[model samples]
Target: MTRYRTTDGKEDMKQKVHWFGAAAIPLAFMNGLFFGGYALRKIRQYWEGGPMD
Candidate 1:
């Protein structure tokens, strides 16, 4: 079996985030907030294509 390291596995996400394909910022933001931010965390998760995104 082949095992992937952190550096080896982040390329896909790095490219996605770097390209700013419209879904990156929102998903990142929601993830960050939900993980450790404010009450709006839940709200952010559902606010796709929103102004903040």
Candidate 2:
């Protein structure tokens, strides 16, 4: 494994935080969208009076 090192500790921390936010925001948004879509589908099925399986 390769270790990434930076000369400035604060900068390293900032970079890590930035990277985390960049990755996490899109992941969370996609997850929310997936669940939201499922919820909407279930709602539509209920509206149609269909048996959920």
Candidate 3:
């Protein structure tokens, strides 16, 4: 689903920022800082590591 991006695509990025921003901020606060930070770290780890254990 590569966009090829023949047009200006800032709106798409902004849209995503808005969506995830809505969920991630308060959700992270609810979960507390340590767990929230660790979860984000693990997500980045998995992203780089091809989802392997």
Model 1 C-alpha lDDT per residue in residues 1-53, reported as the tens digit of each score: 22234655653322222345566779898998777765565568667545463
TM-score leaderboard ranking = 2, 3, 1
- Candidates 2 and 3 compared: the better one by TM-score is 2
User: Between candidates 1 and 2, which one is better according to lDDT?
Assistant: 2
Off by over 4 Å in 3: 1-31, 50-53
Each model's TM-score?
0.30, 0.56, 0.34
Model 3, 1-53: lDDT tens digits are: 12233376543333233566568878878789878788988998888986555
Clash count in backbone of candidate 3: 0
Clashing pairs in 2: none
Displacement of the residue 27 alpha carbon in candidate 3, Å: 15
Candidate 3 least-lDDT 10 residues: 9-18
State each model's CA lDDT, in order.
Answer: 0.57, 0.73, 0.64
Model 3 Cα shift for residue 12 (angstroms):
60
lDDT, candidate 3, at 48:
91
lDDT of 1 at 5: 41
TM-score of 1: 0.30
